[model samples]
Target: MSLASTSLEYIAYFSEIVLAIIIGLAVGAVVMWIGGYDPWQAYYQLFVPSLTTPYGIYMTLSFATPIILTGLTFAIGVRAGLFNIGAEGQMYMGALGAVLYGAVSLPFFAYLPMEFLTGILLAVLWGFIAGWLKAYKGVNEVVSTIMLNWIAYWIVETMRVYVIPNPIDASKTVSVPPSGRLPLLIPNTELSVGYIIAVLAAVLMYFILWKTVIGYEIRVVGYNPTAARYAGINVRKVALYSFILGGVTSGLAGVCEVAGRPPSYAITTGLSNLVNLGFDGLTVSLVGANHPLGIILSSILIGAMKAGSRNMQIFAHVPLEMVQTVQGIIIIALSVPGVVRLIIRRIRR
Candidate 1:
């Protein structure tokens, strides 16, 4: 790419980030105004505390850890010309794999590595099913993945609540043994090594996608499958690799949540807390422009919003729904850059 073109692309990215934040905040302000709340104060609670306070920082990192992995999950799929909507289901299966390992009592080294690998393999197979169908049977990946998601959900849910039954707490999966759990970063806090893994995963993903031969082929296939096929690339192989790699990252995310967060190294019976992480990952990928570094930054923003939502409610009296609204506005802005461009065009004219 030419220097000028590269510079313009950077400018456009900057514009998207600025415009999305501005639009989300502006709409959120209006919503808060209608509800007789102070938008500025609410936003302060939403953004500032996550950075300034120790506990908030820990919680934000805790939340960001998994989403970073999941964000990369979708980001990788996007780069490989696949839309992996089944990250949620793959995550569940990954959790189940780890949970099964959790039931055993092994040394720390054996348990941690084995459990994580088991989770990754399970999720990879789960995602590969959809990819295989698309590659071989001409099935729509979206339809196949969506159906696989529900199949995974019921399978895991039934196993968690009924099949295993926790022997004590029927509503939650049995906790991971201490030796199998992730090591904590801070003493007596929820912070763990998951954040470090997340950062490394992002770095590795960025390197692989931009710096490797296989990655080059995958990107080429994504950019133009016909061209790639003409060049003798095995389109089916690339597609399966894309799906499986995405699943690997997502599976790592599942084990992170299960092993990193202390005092609750168990999956719950219902989808109350673990809901829509995959969709949130899709949102993060959109907001991040599907770049690894960008994904990490966007995941941080999302983690902050989630970590601080309760504080916003308690201190600023803003409803939790307002935070959701702000996120929606951001997603809308990112999804339809034309809206921002139209406003900019009118201003220029």
Candidate 2:
């Protein structure tokens, strides 16, 4: 393509992204107003708290850990036109993998490799099953992945309650050994080495998806499987690869949680909180146009909203559900461009 064409394409892409962000904010504002609150105050509640104290910053980073990883997982699947909805299950498997490694005999240094590898492997295994089903059994990936998630939940519940029984005292939650914990790099902060790892993962994924032939093949397959086959690419293989890759990323998110945040195994009340991570990652990827860097920025924005929502509620007397409403509005407005266009037209009229 000519340089002018390339420049125009980049401009168009960036413009769409800006529009998406604006739409998300506008919809969120509207929702907040409908709730009988000032939208600006609602926005302040969502963003201001994390900026006020060190503890708040720490909390924000802690929340961001899994989100960054899950975003990547979601990005891979969506890029390939496959809905790998079993991220919740894959995350559980990854957590199990980390826990199992922590439960065994190992040195501190060994903990890092052992935990990460175990989580990655388990998640990949889970992802592979869905991929296999789709490839050979002609099963829909959506259905297969959803089923796998249920199976994963049972698997983890079994291990948590009976098999091995990793309970922290009689609390029924197992605390990881000192060695299994991530090394904190900052004083008085929850920030850990995992943040560095998360940053690296983002960079690596960018290269994998943009600079490699495999990425090209995956994109081609995703855009048109039949055409990919005609172009001599193995669509099945690429699809399977995308699913597995997505699983690995989700597994890594589990690792971040186990290593960086909780550093212990609980019954996963955070499951509801974390499961949507994969979904959030899906949104980030979509809003970002599946660009790796874009996904990271989007993840950070979401992390900020999550971190700030509590403060917003506490300080502004805004209901916490407003945050959820805002997120929903953003999803709807961005995902349905036609609606936005209509709204814009009406406003113009």
Candidate 3:
């Protein structure tokens, strides 16, 4: 394609994404009206808190950090033309691994690297297995990853409730040792150093996707495995590499939640908390056109909606279900091919 055509294509893709979000919001407003809720109240809750309160901003940042990582996970997989449905599982395993690290106390310098590395390694191993099953055994990653997520949930719960340092009253795991925790920068706030790490990850993702030879090969393979193979790219290796990258990104999300947000570990916490984020990552990936920087912004937008919803419920008397409906509308608009194509056509004209 000519440079001008390529540029036009990029514009069309981005326009589609923007249109999806707008359509999503419009659908959400309709859902609210049909549900007998005030659409103005719903919109206020969706947008107000992040603007009004410091705590809301802090929570928004906290929410943004992990979703950004998870979004990156899905984005990487999609870019490589692989459907990795196992990010939730990988995230759970990573959280479980981080909890294990939390069981022991180590000085700050030694603790940070060891704990982070452990989480990443565990997630990588899980991802590797999925990739191997897909590449060698011809199993579909979507199936394997979905099953893996269930296994992860059970394994983490079993370990937390029965295995390590479990006390009779231990519904929650013990607080992570102070040394194992992520350092806090914002005083008296939920915000932590994870935001910095998340930002770095986005920048790193951009560089890898646009600047690296390996990334180019991965994209080529995704575009067409036959063409990539003819060009001497190892399609299997690239797929496996994409799987590993996805796992690692999700792992980072797990570690950040355990180390920074909660300041400790809980049994099945990752699995439970990731209910929205796991799926939302797919939304973010779609909304952002699978671009790293775009994912970050999209994540922030969603995070703000989530964090602000509480205030809307408490102060504005809006139902929490309405918030969820809004999110669903957004996701559906992005996912449906016909809606997106129509939007793109309109924008192009």
Question: Which segments of candidate 1 are over 4 A away from where they belong?
Answer: 338-349
lDDT of 2 by residue, 147-177 (tens): 8988988887777666546454543336556
Best by TM-score: 1
List where candidate 2 sits over 4 angstroms from the true fold.
Answer: 1-7, 51-58, 164-172, 263-273, 334-349
Task: Kindly list the per-residue Cα lDDT of model 1 for residues 1-349, writing each as its tens digit.
Answer: 6999967976797687777788878887887888788989988998899978998998888888888888888878777777778888888777877888756767777988887999999999998998899889988887988899889888888888766557877778888888888889998888899899988999999998989988898888877788899999999998898888888988988888888887878888674445678777777776777778888888888888888888888998876677677656656765555334334533543
Show pairs that collide, candidate 1.
Answer: none
After TM-score superposition, the amount by which residue 158's alpha carbon in candidate 2 deviates from its true location, in angstroms, is 2.8
Global local distance difference test of model 1? 0.81
Between prediction 2 and prediction 3, which has the larger lDDT?
3
Tell me the tens digit of each residue's lDDT in model 3 across 1-349: 6999978977887777677777887888888788887878767766777757787788888888888888888888777877777878888777777778656767767766876898899888889999999888889888998898888778877777766543534556655567777877687776889888988998898899879998898778767777888899988898899889888888888788878876334444334655556667777776777779988887777778778778768876767776667766776876664336434543543
Error of 2 at 92 (Å): 1.3
Provide the global lDDT of candidate 2 against the true structure. 0.73
- Please identify which of the two predictions, 2 or 3, would achieve the higher TM-score against the true structure: 3
In model 2, residue pairs whose N, Cα or C atoms come closer than 3 Å (at least 3 residues apart or on different chains), thus clashing, are 45-312, 168-173
